[model samples]
Target: MDAEQQYHTVLAIAGFDGSGGAGIPADIKTISALGCYATSVLTALPVQNTLGVQALHAIPPEVVVKQLDALLTDIPPQAIKMGMVHTKAIVSALTKRLEAHTKVSLVLDPVMVSSSGHQLMEKSAIQAMITKLFPLTHILTPNLDEASLLAKMPIKTIDDMLQAGQKIKDLGCQSVLLKGGHLKGNTLTTIYFASDGQQHTYSFPKIETPNAHGTGCTLSSAIAAYLARGENELSAITKAQHYVYQALLQGKDVAIGKGKGPLNHFFDPEKTIKRKAESGKQGN
Candidate 1:
């Protein structure tokens, strides 16, 4: 490989799922699939699968800080995605490290609950996330359930989603994307609220399938990858959501586990790479 030939890079700081359904593995897969190189820092080691998370063990704050420090000093990332921050200590470390390097676009996917109804984060961590983590985030991606929790209300309708977006934004993030997958409807809508008072709505046909695990993780990582590839924020998000929609459509009914399985992150990444390469050539 030529030393001058460089690809976009996204640094994912998330938990590790032993089953490879979500967390760091899923983030890596999503980033790579979106035509970017992926690097990672582990926040926790969770024994999890499609069925659900079994256990969680968070990495120490000091270790997490060290990893960020080394990465920032060396090959710094253009975009960063964070998932499954299980402790307040880890949240603090993330905030501090990000404060030092404010150029990288940061996506925070608040992974608060498990698929099986287990709490994935502590109450203290929730407070810390809002206080310490939110202000540093470029985008706060939250699914319906998470939006409901953070917004302190039920999100059963589009109006509720709008309300929730405002509430989440009040937490101090630069923007909020409230995913409407959990709403009871044939159409899935994702609402975006930017700090500039601009709001955008994206709608796609809902894919009814059991193989939808890690959708949040995949979506956030994809957005980061797109951003790293030099796309505008809204364009990056729109492209990423379309990628997830396509991945879900391709992987529907594909059974890899007993319960809700993971998305086919390996569906097709080459097309993305080729398209990007052609676009670059045209630019020159």
Candidate 2:
């Protein structure tokens, strides 16, 4: 096949955030920045801003299924990033689609709550999500709150994190990128566990910033984008984490809205080359 014909595509199954802080916008930004084409499916329409979510409207399961099927028929994605699925019906539809399209790699961002402390998914949808989609996931990215919810226990200490990692793996995901943002300390740690039973941890010096939003969405989408580009799961996760951290560190000084603003998704030079070329051509 020609090189252009072999272009990698990433599908993002997530909600719509008009503010671009989280959901499909963040997923598309992260994937595009990481050198992949992004396709999106909106699961929820939320009234939100940088401060928080005000209300949400879940898209019907039939509509969700139709959109997914249309994408599968026309543009087959190499990897999928799932975020903010608001209902069990949506989860059921997605699982059915995944069953039909089992070849695609999946990166799951279990987005239960927004960074500004807004609940995205319903309490009832949790178990359905765990049973239906967790096993199909190639990598599950969850913050401390999400991890604790999924683990059904408090994840406060290092030992608790490890135990939760193990338990999460046993729940059927191929790997877990357990985020530690909610843990208190001078440093932040994220744990990665592969299906092969190997565990690795990445830690970063905590930067004092309240403007970090969509970090989880960005990380998971970056991982999916890299995986679509043929990187292994562990390699993809490491690079994605570094990408997100740097994006956060760079955007720490900039201001966007009243609440938590977005990270600098364009922090990588190599990743921005294609975009710059396109813009330069457009300017001509």
Candidate 3:
């Protein structure tokens, strides 16, 4: 096969959201919409919808490892996006499997809670994630609430976000994208702190809408998609944010459920992107 015929591949490791508004489903939509082939490994099963999470069933560590092994061996991804790792065992399993894939760009959305206020991660797993997965992460995308929890500090303002981002970055990730969607005001600011001591702040008008389900998953997956297409970290994040913003704007008026609705992932979908496959590799 011609190298140019190969599609850029992105793998999403996340929980299963039956509602299709979040988790692996949202990741797939976001990745595919951004013109990348999407692969996934389920980490947990959360029984919930746009309303809230009711119950959860985490995948066993061994099974999760087997899934990772199968995908990593057969369909090696150029980039990876991880969400909803609910247990310390799963975190450890992921770290062990991913340690060798240092070349792959990894976007970790430290999903700790749902939009409806349900805890998605086990408290004990926080430390494990910081110690094990953070180092392997190319970019850690955490919202205000999750950042506060990880940094063990309050983040009510941009200054607080900057301080918390530094604290999280010190935990060993290559970079941190601190999302400030929860901050009060008409303008939303997200800060990106790079490993080289560079910081970029992105501010945009807040779109007032209740249909924001799966936003974090979408943004992180979009970032992974852009990275798979060979974009630099800053470029990837900038494009991903634009994608999410447009999705939210396009889907704002549309209603899906009684509770919060989801973004229009297919608002302006792009065809699958093709790239030259690296020699000896399936996709890149």
Candidate 4:
């Protein structure tokens, strides 16, 4: 593709989910759905299935740093999305790289907990994320469970989500997308906490499915991809949610694994690629 039409690439620094539901695979799918390329740097390897994560082994901190440096040295992405950092060492390694390279857009998905009742990051790692990475993030996307963990308080209601959103903003992020998925209800709400002190609430009718494994990863990556393609932050998030909703709707029936299956990231009802290629060949 020509430079004008070349796909923008997003660097995803996260873990590997063998389940393909979350982590690096989900990030790649989300980026592709938005018509962007994705480059990955895996920090951990998780033995997971549709049911849940079975085991995890974190990559060495120095190895993770080496991956980041290799990518940055050759070709820096238009955006960066962070997922699972299993230790304070990994967090520090990431922070050092970020400090060295100050000219990148970063979307931090503070994944402290897993869907199957497991803590992914140690207390020191969580603290390092708050101290080192939060300030540099263009946007931070954390679910209610994550928000509560960070806030050191329970988030049981919409009011709590609102409060947590502001508190997250106080942690130095330019904006926060507080997802309200863990709260019990038929409706799901997400709040956007802007650095300008403006807050906006987005609500969607919750789809009842046990297979919603990679929603957070997908959402954050989608936001990053859109931003890389020149969309404003708010606009990027809004569009990303729309894309996610459609993917969920498409994957509701297709079961790939025994546990919670992933949403179909590529659900192009129209064959846009084929049509574009034909048009290009015909000099249209």
Candidate closest to the true structure, highest TM-score: 3
Query: Per-residue lDDT of 1-284 in model 1, one digit per residue for the tens?
Result: 33434567789999997777788999998988877888899988888777887887778999998988887776677799999898888888788779976788999999999878878899899999999988889999999989988999998899999988998999899999889998887999999997698999999989889998889999999999999888988998999999999999999979887888889898888433322232232211
lDDT string, candidate 4, 1-284, tens digits: 33224447789999998878899999988887777778899999988888787888979999999999888876567789999987999998889889866567799999987888777889999888999898889899999888988888899999999887888889888899999987898988999987777888889998876668899999999899888777888898898888888888888888788878898888863222211222233221
Estimate the overall C-alpha local distance difference test score of candidate 2.
0.85
Steric overlap count per candidate: 0, 0, 0, 3
What's the best-to-worst order under TM-score?
Answer: 3, 1, 2, 4
lDDT of 3 by residue, 181-252 (tens): 999999989999997999999999999888999999999999999999999999999999999999999999
lDDT (Cα, 0-100) at 109 in candidate 2: 90
| Ten-residue stretch with the least lDDT total in model 1 | 275-284
lDDT of 3: 0.93
Across 93-178, the per-residue lDDT of candidate 2 in tens digits comes to 89988987777889999888876677888887888899999879889998889998888899998889999988888898888989
TM-score of 4: 0.92
- Worst lDDT window (10 residues) for model 4? 270-279
Once model 3 is optimally superposed onto the true structure by TM-score, how far is the C-alpha of residue 131 displaced, in angstroms? 0.6
Model 2: CA > 4 A from native: 1-4, 269-284
